[model samples]
Target chain A: MKKSIDAKKGKGPKAKLSNDQLLTLYRNLVRADHFDKCYVRRIQAGQLISFYHAGEGGLAPGVGACSFLRKEDILWPHHRAHAQGHMLSKGIDLKYYLAEHTGKTTGCCKGRSSYHWSFPEYGVFGTSGCIGAGFSPTVGWGLACKKNGDGQITMMCCGDGGSNRGTAHESFLMANNWKLPIVYLIENNGLAIFSKHEDMHPTKDIADLAKGYGMPAVIVDGQDVIAVAEATLKAVEHARAGKGPYLIEAKTVRIQAHGVGLPDLVDYTPRSKEEIDELRERDAILICRERLLTEGLLSQELIDQIEAEATQEVADAERFADESPVADQLDLSDINKLVYAE
Target chain B: MREITLIEAIREAYIEEMQVDEKVFLVGQDIRGGNFPNTTGLVEMFGDDRVLDTPISETAMVGSAFGAAQMGYRPVVDFMSGGFAYVAACEVLLQSAQHYFQHGGNVSVPLVITAGVGAGLKLANEHSVTPHAMFLHHPGIKVAFPSTPYDAKGLMKSAIRDNNPVCMFWHLALMMEKGQVPEEEYLVPLGVADVKREGTDVTVVATGLQVKHALEVAANLESEVSVEVVDLRSMEPLDYEAISRSLEKTNRLVVVDEDTERCGFAAELIAQVVDKSFDLLDAPIERICIDNMPIPGGYLEAHVLPNPAKIETAIRRVIA
Candidate 1:
């Protein structure tokens, strides 16, 4: 049986991250929230056309966990904005992300892939449009890391819906058997678009599924960046020590509609206005801000300054995306060139 | 030259490729157990680290290979049989095939998916299939079907070295068939065709096991019909030029394939030939392909598959 460690209850030891690091984590949470809100505004204004999933409440898991990874360590992100926001926090240029969104030649993927941006130079190997597809490749990356004896761990993010895929289980078995240094981070936001965890899955806890594979599993409150960082630190340490793959299920809530305030968002998500408000009150950025203020790690003035800077950064990114050139019309001769490598 | 079977030739290519490139590794089901003769001793040679025996997870294995290839490793994934390609169709077609192009030609997937194909073994509906047509239809992937031991070694080497994803279908019936393979290293380029027999009366384009049958038919009709056999070693980068050149000499054509008659490789080949050099044709193109139906078990399997007699009949009909 797998032992379930919950960081929300503060059951385990506190995270060893310094006060400066904690402040940085809080700042990233604010930045991710701001970035998401900017994208939402852009979409509403018809300035940006995108499949936008708001990462309001789920910023901590993405931002905090990614902070522990090294430059060589790879991150296989999911299609959600939380993962993209994590990439942004990891210093992936805001211009590249915005440019890719606008289908510009200056995009990270050269306007080829819109949301599924891959910058291997920044250790962001790639993300897949298909659910559960990224798991296997992350395992492969882990295998490569193990063979090279590079001590570079691979962190793969998947939703609760994607975790139910056969590929995820297969990856778990393979990673476990080979003892590949990989962290299967399940961002259990309790919603698979419209379907809730209780409706879609049999087990109450997503981490419990790891028991059958005999892998170490943990459950953490994704709203708490410190808890997430602590859980992730444990998982990363276990993997780096060659103790095999570890599973961390960060239980959080999706604060907004699945994508861009679709007409079916309210019809599909049967949550009351009161319940939605209650969920919003537990938002990670809000919680982190409160915690930072209480612990004397950040002042209201500094927090306001950080928010202003982040808003300005988003404005700058929008300008960069607007100024970036779109890809030129392809010649018939060059049509087949992109199909195969030179 | 060394006399080796098709399976031996495949095994030798893996051995040589793995011996030279540390990045080259094998991953599949029962590879360590050596259930498939082609990958029999690879585990013993390379050990478990390199020759990984994966669980019965086709999607995971293929997807992992695609990922590893992106990470600068040449992964040779064995699906055990071509029938399993259906199970891994999404990963092969969507992930591996589309990765290079979808990334704006920025990434390369050096993945070789080796599977035993064709329907002569009577392995029932699930196991018996010649589905190279499905892969050949895709744009980014390079599909190869080697009929002879020599071509098998050379093509396998080239497929491993090539940057694109290559789906290599080894006909099950021809696995043990012996053919002369040069001891020195040689690569059969992906899009090239070899003329097994040259004649003026008719031209036959055949792939995989059908290539052997086409050659046999050409030899049997030596006195009756002067037949030219063009072995299409690679299916995707199809040697249409070679077929058109052969058609220049022999204006009649008989295309032989193990796949079904409807919308298959043979049909595609004929269409391309007609498009390129329709005026050169002295007669209508004849396609010797398997009847469009599920391959039955036992004796009926032989009847459904394309044979030398079928090739000869098609050749005679086209030439007449």
Candidate 2:
């Protein structure tokens, strides 16, 4: 059972990833999961200002993929940006995010975005609740990268439902027209909030939209960390090489309800019990751990250490959130200070 | 002081700002030749890197301007026409303006969204109609409607230097009008009103091209009545003081706006005057604005835009 994990790819030698780098990514995912869990608990305790509906799944995809990105790159996420924010913990202090959610002073965006999304310094621009609204701004960042001749590219994350928004189409057309270096990631987690992708979109393949715009598109198993990472690295490389825009459709599953308030009756209604169970079995974190263990890349001691450290980090973040200051109405004045002379 | 057309004044402002500040640049559709002639001579002066002539994508252009401003550059975006602002509304009103307060004072979006407002030429419905009311309703935005060449230069310079997002509406017809401007660097403060003329019998609150028309109507009727004319240079943080002062002096008020009558600047001004300066009123406030219909074509355009005849009628009614 203890085979070399180095033979991951078809190449004679698997590309080596530093242990520190792997640990950082794993740690970020744990933090993301902890933040979302705390968000659910706080909402249940009625301590939150706005209710975000991304509590369905555990940690896996959003945080997992985000952990692989460079800190300087721009990130545009949809309404379900919980894991994304958590994974970028280094870029965004968790206290600010919690404060924002709880309408507190220490919130990343104060309480202004309490009713909606946030924009931390982590290059994560505010999330678009309006389906595909994040595409154009992300494209703008990509254009900025091209203009500045910087190696940085923008990552636009949206759901299957957002793929149909006219703004998203316009964003792609313009992105191709100007050859803006960006990566469009579609999380086809079967549902766009309440509506299933089948009922929403006429075309089954969302990635095909990229080809019409003259951009390369890829479909990947989103639940598989290695698959998602490989696809992302390819897209990142393409953009870095000035190959213009690319799209990746990640087929994943939301193992829970759309958000915290989903009626228990609707659970597994759209999806078969067997399918749901199978998807859940393929949890991204579990898959990564199993792969590491089976390939002998990580020992039991190392795994235990990571889990314990991640748990401790989550506990610390939760304590920080609880002790954070609540936001006041006068704090709204802070938002206006920088608009003009202040 | 040298004389220049409204277009020339805006161009000079861009040129002067670009020459002085390394952070200032231009972005818009067809910005190379200065789309609509507002950027004329800019490409020759600042080069392509700064004066970016973008594709016909309002969202990209506006979004790019928003990003660039976030990156510490002052972007003077030419949205071309008022209608185009609707396309980039998400970026301007929602993201650009709202971000200042929404992001908890995290980002400074020093962007100037310039567009041609009101209809004088027969450009028909798609091109005409003043849509500034939409922006005025939103906080965190500075809206400027300059009537003359001088105000255009001064206000634009002020807009470029200001940290907040400033929406500048320049009437297309006034683009060719000439006015005196100071040669030295200067900034006309935001949220301030300019009293174009002094009077006592009645007050005329005007904005954009209507300010000119109101001034003309007041001049023609000078001997008969002393009409006070106040140009609402800034629409959002409206110079309530100036309007209130005028209302206190004249008692009779007539608000003239280039935009439509419903939910327009006139409505807001009248409401404020009635609320704060109720005791100063001699008669019920009147408004001179376009009919609540789409901007018409051919001969109807002259009929559609607020005219001196309409202002005169409103003034006479209030004073009578």
Candidate 3:
């Protein structure tokens, strides 16, 4: 039996975002798409050397999920797209963030972490290389919020691939048992690094795990920024109200290959030109752009301006990263001075 | 000074730390039930929220501590047994150790992780292994195994107060071992070694339960070889200087460790000592440790484990 509480079914609190909020969500989606494109361009042009999971088609879910979040709320980023959209939307400094990505000293981790990006000031503690490991620490963050008696809530996302780990179920049960303030977000791109969801998971909705824990869960159209944001806003309110955890499974698409510098293959075969085009048609950025144009919320002049500004911002960030110094490893002759904190 | 069991010393440390800081709390499986006796009555003192008892979830148990620690709360976690520490390997080994350095030292994971480790009492393959070597392999983690009640009380206090992730694995076999502990506060700092006995002929460096075996052998052989016994209470941030000073007096080195023999901590100690003081060695070094095999249950366990007999044999071999 299907046990998920559908956010679209009007059974729970539906988000009613203001016009300004809607436009803000649209702008965030556009910037997320732009940052991803910039990252891909640099990787393709050989200007940067780093591992990045290109999130071109999947940016909306993270951007929307983080749209209503405050700077005080913790966001444990999923490895998809290296969590750039979530980080940027949650307010990680763009120039330093890009610089860190480029291995420059001006980066957030002082270039110590090329990809495990963390800005605690912005409520993002570092992410783990192991996929499902994020669940437990995120619970800890939630536990802290509960213990502090502060209204701060923790939001974390895992790929459909990572959701199957025992950590996920354990964390969920523990969080519910303690009634910790957390929003468990699922970025269901339906592909766990080339394996489709149909073959990988049973029962389609991973949020069913939430139902098993006796927690409220929702499923939303991940490409639709407004929808994702609305679902997120309601879920965030549910958790912030001391109602325990809320699970949101955003059904998104990953149009690009898992990582850059890799051939685009889905199901062990190179994606056909028509299949690629069809996937592009479902691109969250393109979809959002078309919807805004149709709604007359954004004029062609405004869209052009946003794109041009995003392009310039990306170029300036690239230049800043390229000009910055590589992180220095020496500190008064002790090479591992940064390894331990005094 | 009054004598207390090793388990009582640990309970005292928890009671003292919790009384000292409001942020200090305990989290683990059946902790509220005081199922381990060390955590007995902790819930009555600190209440449910602080003395968090969770279902059998090892990774989340540690991870919750990690989160709470990051938020500036000090948490003390007990894994029940060292062998089960592997259940939360990613959380314990990767997240706790790496989060600080990877995040540019912006976070402080101040937590003490303890597990009842080492073979004895026929606990078999799953529950009867020591895990200090696994923690020592990781750079940022601090590993300690307190062999006495006094050291258990003091070292645990230091670990709880230290601003890093610390794995303080006490010997399950040493739980009832009694020793004098001061009523007043004191600390046995990490990275320091204690010379259990002084001698001039040979130096035996050991940790955990092996320290007791070495001391017994040192006393039993006093008539012949005047043996010096060095207790390394902590592995990471090890007190190599003390070992060097002991080697300076006693030219022969023999290590007795209860863990595996092949590619083990005993080998590591010998390699490091030999590298630093090749001229100090008047004879080849010897190691008394468990041969490479899973420790068997019942009487069969004694054959593979290091005992006073093994320590005496190794000391004699190194001296001759």
Candidate 4:
């Protein structure tokens, strides 16, 4: 049965985005959801063998926040679903990304990196396999931008689990002390692997920690694209104005298992059917679809067309990856080749 | 030629490198204030932007250096003492050491980490330790342990220019040791060994502060044994060819290291020699190293650390 897009009764928050931008943002969210679904199917079918994290309910914040960044700005991403959406929105080729996942020679890191990939030309500095490991480096990027007088800002993303790391506190202290042009976007999905935020941390809101660091912070609804965009834009402006780093905590939901169907091993998700249904109703894609429909901005046919286009794009990427050449076999002498650059 | 201390030579290298390349910057704790003598006056010359002073967070500072290197900047990090490396081991090993190969050789980390090692200042175990063995065990980075002021300046210059991560270990006791350094620009290429004193009876291979002791012991034993001292300036890309040549002539080997004797540089060097040139050896090799124990403060440090007397004893034992 197809789920209907039910527009809420009363008028919602004023649409801060244009019709065209809203359409673009909606299309990106749909694309990320479709890509994640395709990844799960491929993994189950044994066609793809790699770790996967579904960014089902958090696409709005990922797309909205990343859309404001310019080509000169840098992004330090985490190793999860939001990073994929952020990279795809920033014009990183899906074909190359897919090829990388399949361990092809033409991939982003030439099949070397499975998840922690860097596309520097697009200002995606890279992601680290270790959680919160990129925080300090993000500050360094901001320092470089300031030193070069480039007027560029750095947007670093972390999950609720990563925010609790000591590296995060150290980075926050340094960024505040140096007044670096950086925006620390904490995508609080309420759970870190299996533990909820309440169980993991004492604070009610992660942004509250920013006050202790002497930096401005805000908490926004992760499901609302317009709210995320407004909050991110304000943070970006503050950093560009040389006022130092700003922290934004976007409260969202992790609607799927941490990885691709490892539920038998460990699953902390809501088990009841009604609870899962309630969580599904709050899906960012569905909410955005309902808003667009009620605002008379887009029709059902247009939404279906946009979603179909995204599915086709993912198909083309999978085909490209399937036909791409695998990495060459490494010889004993090859071991010494990459140890040193010189 | 002008004579300068090892610290002065290192400072000169920093100044010259920073002047030549605008991308080269110094970032660490107390660097701007010149708390470490090698970084003195650098902030005054390069200004605050180029010479940065970081907080007391070693992990964050080292991790930032790694990030800056990835972003096309050459960052020279000052760790103050080698013992502090334990605090940032994750950054050094997981991030910096794995950056090159992790990205499929797409990125190069041009980072130079300078740290003081060895025990002589009564600073106890936390401040004094020769941890080059730990770094040498890692595959990605280049390790340089310079004994003389000339090698210190040359090796540091080379480290700054090389498109790879390099760790230069400076002995705290050798900081004020004076030696003649050429006024003109020069760089002693890494991975090359220098023979401080040549002999034909027995070969004593050493690194860092141990090289000075080995040279002295070789000089004093001229009448009893002809001791050849090979200063392995770089530990990672060891001078195996030089070691082989020395072994062919001397037929006896004595390895001296400041690290512990078990599974340390001395053990590795002996194993390599035994594997490559075992037939050329006239007798069993001798090793002079600190026993398996923590370096304590005060005069006990002198008893644990290898000295000229220990090097001499090892040389005589090997030649006997």
Best of the candidates, TM-score: 3
Report the C-alpha lDDT of model 4 over A1-342, residue by residue, as the tens digit. Answer: 111111221113333667887777788888878777777777778666468787777777787788768887888865567377788777777777777778888777788776667688888766667888878687678888777776788889888999999889889988888899999988888877777788889987888788787787777788877677767887788788888898888888777777877561123545566655787788888778888899898897898799789989999999998998986665567675767787
Off by over 4 Å in 4: A1-16, A264-270
Candidate 3 lDDT over residue span A209-317, tens digit each: 7767888888888878877898888878888989898898888888788999777777797878887687778777677777777877888898888888777877788
What is the lDDT of every predicted structure here? 0.83, 0.75, 0.84, 0.82
**DockQ, in order, for the candidates?**
0.67, 0.48, 0.78, 0.66
* Interface root mean square deviation per prediction: 1.4, 2.4, 1.0, 1.4
Clashes of each: 0, 3, 0, 0
**Candidate 1 chain B weakest ten by summed lDDT:** B98-107
Instruction: Give the range of the ten consecutive residues with the poorest summed lDDT in model 3 chain A.
Output: A1-10
Alpha-carbon lDDT of model 2: 0.75
Candidate 3 lDDT (Cα, 0 to 1): 0.84
Chain A TM-scores in order: 0.93, 0.85, 0.93, 0.91
Candidate 3 residue runs with Cα over 4 Å from true position: A1-10, A290-296, A328-336
Model 2 misplaced stretches (Cα beyond 4 Å): A1-16, A55-59, A84-86, A89-91, A115-120, A263-270, A331-341
Ten residues in sequence with the least summed lDDT for candidate 3 chain B: B131-140
